[model samples]
Target: MAEWRDPQWEYFAIQSLRGKSFGDEWPTIPEFFQYTVERFPDNSAFTTFAGEQRESISYRELAQYVEALARSLQNLGLTAGDRVAVSGKNSPYWGIVYLAVLCAGCVVVPLDARQNGEFHKHLAEFTEAKAVFMDGDLLAKLEEAETEQPAYRKYLIQSRKDFADATGAKWETMWQMIESRKGDTTGALSSLAQIRSDDMAALLTTSGTTGNEKLAMLSHANFTSNLIQCVYPGLQEILSTDRLYLLLPMHHCYPMTAVFLEGISHGSELIFPRGLAVQQILQDLKDGKVTVFMGVPMLFNKIIQGVLNKVKAQPAAKQLMFRLMMGISGVSDRMGKAIGSKLFSGVLKAMGFDHIRILICGAGVLMPEVGEKYRRLGLNFIQGYGLTEAAPIVTLNPAGTSEVRSVGRLLPMITGRLESSPELSAPVVSVRGHEVGELCIDGPNKMSGYYKNPQATAEAFTEDGFLRTGDMGYFDRNGYFYITGRSKNVIVTAGGKNIYPEEIEELFQLCSWFEQVMVRGYREDGTEKTELVVYPKLSEDCVARIAADRDAFLSGDTVKDPAKQEEIIGVQLHREILADVQRISRKLPDYQRIGRVRVILLSLEMTTTQKIKRFLAESRFAQHNDGLLTESQDF
Candidate 1:
């Protein structure tokens, strides 16, 4: 129906080059590296921008560094099956070390650099990691946390200064380890023949949203299979020359497999930002000419809100025209014709998405409306579902041929089933003649098991052997999978009605007043009510206005008492926010509508991965409610 929409998208995993290329289908990740090296030897593999200076390395250069690092580890007593941990921000060095460890036949443990020393020590002890590579400061903290260290431990410090000779000759660790040993590739070569596809390549911890932390052992075959799945037709159509902006933490599976590995396998250049500061991100986007953007829902929510809020605040005629255009664009999309891309081309360019062709959202539920907003803006926005155990990508919306509401079609060779259960926090909702249930999946991309945790691993699978996703979802008649919410996060009302907080939470996001919102069911006496814990950042203008009102009230004889003046301003602020909440609540069923609004000064606590820690939110809200600055409720 549209020029951008392609009706014919063949499933690629089934037809992947596993058996065709190099005579073996299940090749190790290191082998995948070798394949890319052979084809694009001098192509830009990695790049980092610092201030006005830019430094990068080619595929061949990356391979030599990986070989030297492998040899150095071998010299340091690293051997096959020996565990080694890597905790650092995303960098070419992080990528180099990960490949080198696998090339040396050791298991690579990807740790969160944002994690504290105690967590690192626990993971190191659990994996029995004999060596580690981490940022300099984190390294010292981890060492302090682990007292019984052996003498011959390997700790390769991952520094922030570029090692591209631009940082100077004497401070060049890359030159000392790699450039000096450029001629000799003898040591790491032999070990490559010994490693198998099924061998454990990486040991990564879960996001722990489902509960306690557990290590997921992903094999080389598992990741390699997922890489092929990503490149196959109907998925992200990334080119070899595309400069992918690598901003997310590399330790996470979303970036580790999807962007870093997948992009590299396709010969794409990986662009690292100067830093996470907003200016740095914007500069990298403009300078790097980034084509593919990957991020979570929170990031996109801010962008959508910023753009729409500006549009709404414009002159009355401009606001009306913009809204009308968006309405037409959204309508065009529903009919399978995305005229939005053409209609909103000017708006997209003005918003700095000029070079962005594909945008992927994951790690949390992306409300369908958010997806629709971007799609109507002419952006190829998509949402997917997966966890650390599934190599982080089981289903992704294929560009051009996509259902923005559903996550995407299941990747080729991946099978999924829904198991109905009533014991979950809320009753499941049926959609389009399909009943929702716990979505279980079985695939080659699945993890072997949780490392050293047999009990958790045993309970992770169904009797027939599908991995319990801990998520509830359903599938449309056309085979697109739709995620409802985390089964545990669903809230059951007193009327026995199922309310997916995520669904209700999305409705709240439609309002521009709140920065973050969490929907939860709390009981009072004999019944329960759904409440919204909102965190709003006041604008400079709002703060100034409040201050002016307070001073004016205090000076006036009509409000002579100092305490009474403060109360009047406080009441005014609460009523304004509550009025907006009440306006939005009408879209929901009376039972599902928010019964109370609790405004907090602080943000809702979130994990390092940017996921809301639901249990923590419940406990903290129950205990303190301090900074419970304002509230409006209907008891």
Candidate 2:
């Protein structure tokens, strides 16, 4: 391994001691993980649940697996700096392959499982991946999409019974590597390929290629610096315990670095559920005794909402006690006394959060109301803000120094500057004179550049050398950052006031009736008006009543004509949903009030990170109707 030091010595010199040592600053990703292994060789390292099988591996065992895989790849005529692709659901095997590829001095390409096969193919060719490791489903998809045989070597995550490709061929299995090296592994586990700190560690695709590849290229130094920055008073505060809940997909940068690799850095075990199936997640929490849980906005929104709904269904006396405890807990939280653990201890245990210490939500916007509920219920709730280009982490809510509304302060040794986005006309929206500009950051953790796309790379950074994050935000008197909305997502009113649809959308998010809501401005009769597109989620009571009415109609006990009854039910549900939205949305100012509404039956499409893809949704609505808002009725 190369002994790399910070090129910008002057900048690193003033940083706090928190980031001093990480087995040396120039450590490779494999070396860093190995360092943790040396610290806790006998500790439980990884655990995963898949269907009927449950597996656990120790740090020492995991190191041997990585070495075995690297040796296998070496025997196959591959050397350092080769590219390998791994695709599968979140499992311990996926993680093992990911680390093993790096251990062999190969750059890993992690593709999103939700993406299409053609996109995946394009990523493989763009990165020139020499080999691919995939599960049965992905292998089938790859086979169907290709007319000619692919040149890359193939490996399987798990063996498929009697499975054959187009040529009736069987691929090698990942488990074989472990079996071959079970014993009599002397020279195999001893030496590793020489890796430099500046070598490319991974290539992460941001979007579909348009003939110009725009994969975010991160270096070994980039990964190491971020790991050190995070370990030193970074995530180490939350991940100090032994076990962490790996909830999100490993392909996404947030989970890959912040949760997965962060856990390895601290010798904390990871729990990967069978799949993201609802019941599986609950069961995994119970079985794994997860200590740190990291997720996005949707995860916490549903979990917290589920617990609250259960509380409401309790008997009157029990409900009264729960409410009283919650009230007292809220008061105690304000006074810096964490009493929710004792007050709502039963609620926590019931939800399988008996061992949960910290709950970190990132990758999407988290509604403040949901965050407050968790905090009041005695969970340490945190919100983070970042983009893929920054190796995906720029700012996270500090454990003890967190603020309710802010996204916490910038990471230590990371510099954030607010650059004027006069084009968006986001007029310093604060009265206290804080500049509201596109949040641009400068840090060693930032990516080198977009892969082979100089035009895109040039546009990503400013002349002054900060990566322009294209996110419109402002900073408080303290160094904490606040994101208002994306630059392209902002809507300007005729009155020349900047209106962030996210702000208006957040107000409606407080109500569960609207499953998905988006606020956008449309021109109608030469006037720009605010419009809301909604997908309704029926209340439990309303759904039950509707089902009961349908059953009575079917039995011919309530209505003479079933079709008319169905029509009436649909109309009633629409009215109920509209009324609920109107009641909740009235809290917004007159200017921010929605002037029109469009109700779609289907839910809006979201990104892998669970963010609603706004432009695509608008296009979908436009394709189906002449106007996005069919009914220009305002409430």
- The lDDT leader among the candidates is 1
Mark the 10 consecutive residues where model 1 has the least summed lDDT: 1-10
- Checking candidate 1 for backbone clashes, the offending pairs are 18-25
RMSD, candidate 1, Å: 5.8
Report the number of clashing residue pairs per model: 1, 0
Kindly list the per-residue Cα lDDT of model 2 for residues 256-374, writing each as its tens digit. Answer: 88888878877889888766765677778878888888887777777877787787889999889888888888888888887888877877787778788777888767778778888
- Compared with the true structure, all predictions reach lDDT values of 0.75, 0.72
Q: How well is each residue in 46-136 modelled by candidate 1, as lDDT tens digits?
A: 9987677888899887888788878767766778889888888888888888888888889999898888888888888778888777766
Clashing pairs in 2: none
> lDDT of model 2 at residue 623?
59
TM-scores, one per candidate? 0.87, 0.87
Write down the RMSD of all candidates, one decimal each: 5.8, 6.3
